[model samples]
Target: MANRLKRTSEGFISYRFAAIVIAALFFASLAGWIAQELVPPDFVERKAFYGESWRPGLARAVDLLRLHDPFHSLWYRFVLAFFFAVLVACNVSRFRRIALRSLRAELPAGAEELRKRPLSFDLSWRSLAAGPRGDADPLVRYGELHGRREAVDPAALEGFFARVSALLKRRGLRVVSDRADGVIRFTASSGRLRSPGTMLLHAGIVVITIGGLIGSLFGWRGMVYLKAGETAPLPPDSAAVLRVDEFRIVTGHGGAIRSYVSTVTILGTRGETLAAGSIEVNRPLGYKGVNIHQSSYTMGEGEFARASVSYRLRGETGRRTVELRGTASAVLGDGAAVVTALRFLPDFRMGPEGAFSASPFPANPALEVEVSAAGGAQRGWLFLRHPDFNARFAAGIDLALDGVEPVYYTGLELSSNPGAPVLMAGFAAATIGLIFMYFCNPRVIRGIATREGLIAAGVESRWKASFELEFAGIREAIRREFDESG
Candidate 1:
């Protein structure tokens, strides 16, 4: 009844609640699949973060599941939380039983339970050389037990059974009968039950991984896109900052992008530079518990940019703005300077729609730069890049436009969470549990007999063929002894 109660509880937990959690995970995966199939094309705009497009339909899905970062979603957290809870409960319940067993100083033998087990049996056989003395001979049992029925004699089978019986008794089983009919039985057990701990040890790993899943839900991953020649501070704890010093993209023969490289300085909390590295796809920079990689590339040129620092005073509102692109002509109240679009590339696309909208490469690389002193237009088209690269303004105000070096860089992904490790451990535990309980249950044998010349075989459980093989060897030894005596 105790075993039945335990079994019923496990059944309810495993098939009812556990099954439901598993089903929910299954449904979640199915929904994710459907989302993958339908949501992408319907979305018209692309978000640089998480690579999702800005579309009417995806906003709700993305926000609710945190699809911007799905693995860090609530659904995953809910399932993993339940899984960990189940594991904790299972460990507690199982250990409670182990605690009880441990309290006993040692395993006690219920002699009655050991004897009169269901598989008890008996057999009878007559000797070829018959006499009451045949029974009196001490070698009589040994000879018949010797078990080489075709070689020594049937008598050896009896002796072989006796030796095997003694070996079993030493192992703490009570022998019920040993006879010459090639049959033997004994009852045995070991705290060998303690060997079951292999299950717990293996399950521990999955528990750790489940813990990792929980961490991720509470965790966050943010990206820092650093362009060459520029820097931006990262978001707090949920953010990490890095500066891209140099960026390069190696392309295939036909200009298909093959690989990219970005040299950057990684920053930890408080805007501190933690490490400097050259990052790429397979090669990521790990520092401060985050990984940064060169995930993308873009085209832009950095030249000796000549720009006037123009700013409207603190209280000057309403269109009183000072914006600098390259060098531009501007009258700052009473001052004047030159404004030239320096180191101009042909095409630059930015925001939903903005300037530099043409092809950013050399196809139409032309800069229409204007230089005005004291609020007037003195503008001209400058072919700044060339096989010759020589383009300048008329009559020395001295603005030397130098070589335009391209700026290449990428976005770095930073993430940290504690849940992944726990989920992994739980997965490992369940695997080990099944293997130990199913693959290694020991066999309990009990022996008895109804006749003098025959042994009986009995067991509480069927074992692997090992039992049959051992029994056959014993029978052969007995037959050999009997044949020799005859």
Candidate 2:
């Protein structure tokens, strides 16, 4: 039973089955590529796969399949896994066969097969005496001219063939010779290792697929917002904490935002500092396996630090500006009135339940102040937009809201892809395999000895046009040697 199961596994992993699997994978990848191109980059965060934007049924299907994150989808991973398995099986099966073929000293071919090759040509005594002629030369030159030429020198022809053998050897070709009944046969081949170039190419792809599998299984990406002077814990799997030391924005001459920078500090699990640096729009910080990029920033008054206000009295000659925060009180005129800042709100609004703050944004800013003087004490809100709001208070003193400083928070995008190294190695290997397959092309040339002369045939279909030129050169060389032998 175990043997049967093993045989079944091997059968399923055979080249025929593997080709089918590879074709299916190609279509699957094509479908995934098309689907991904239609979706926005942040489809998951923006919740784009829902509601009226997308039809209900299509949205449900996309959501169920996690099509937004196509790279990590179950079907994508399964296809990669299957393709990798097929590549491994195919390489294993072909490797031994290729190795054995390369080891053979001679490869016999049928006469019909040799004649069918495009590079095949029959040479006879009369043809050899006619000198070298290009295939495009006029056919009248081959008529029965029967011109008298010096008898061929056997020693020079032997020397020429020996020279040809040496040239093929210099070019890394294995030359094999066989002689029978006064007929000499020869075969020359180069780039034997490249005989399995196809298998190597597929093996490189398998490595790349394995890399993708690693990334899909172990990689992660997300974005986090950190206010100035705030520390946010990293993901549970990550053993570091990210602190936003400062968020600075550089403005141009016209107050246009030129650039934004975030000073970040990385801390270990026990609060020990590990690394600290600044990250800008195009620049990112790397700590351990996590990459932190300054993605965006928000302006708000969540942690109000200070507020400025103008203070004056009924008989005051000049107005004085007071900076209020944390128990700062100002006396109006001759201490007749007092004003204290209880708290600061960058954006102050009334909630549904009459609460003070409606949101964290500083869209509508207001300051809550306490006033006490002479006969009564009153409390009210001072708004940035309303300058004359202090006139409503008749407590013998007036206060005007000037401006409030807002806190800026920086958003960081964090990503950890553990498979990046494997992917890079796979890419390098794939490039090498491609160079071997195409650049160092392997070719086979077979020569069968006949009573009249030598019949040469070459396997040149892989690169027909290029091989045609190469065959022309070889033919010229043979003709030069044989003609010189005369």
Clashing pairs in 2: none
Candidates' C-alpha lDDT: 0.51, 0.72
Residue-level lDDT tens digits of model 2 in 177-253: 87654555688887665655655677778778778768878998898888877887776466778999888889988
True-structure lDDT of candidate 2? 0.72
lDDT of 1 at 149: 30
Q: Please give, for residues 1-486, the per-residue lDDT of candidate 1 as tens digits.
A: 999998877864554766676677777766666665654543325544324444565566566675444444778767756665665665655676555543432311333443454443222234423334455666654665664232334456555556556666664554454233433333343333433544365356446655764774676677666677566554445465567787777798899877788888766667776778888888987765555655555445533233222233324443233334544444433454446454355553335653353643544344445655544545544443332333343422233223344444466676655565566666666566556556654445544322244343434334646656654544444344344343
Off by over 4 Å in 2: 1-23, 33-80, 98-113, 124-126, 129-157, 166-185, 188-197, 219-223, 233-241, 249-261, 268-272, 278-296, 299-406, 448-452, 484-486
TM-score for candidate 2: 0.63
Please state the error at residue 13 of candidate 2 in Å: 5.6
Q: At residue 338, what lDDT does model 1 achieve?
A: 46
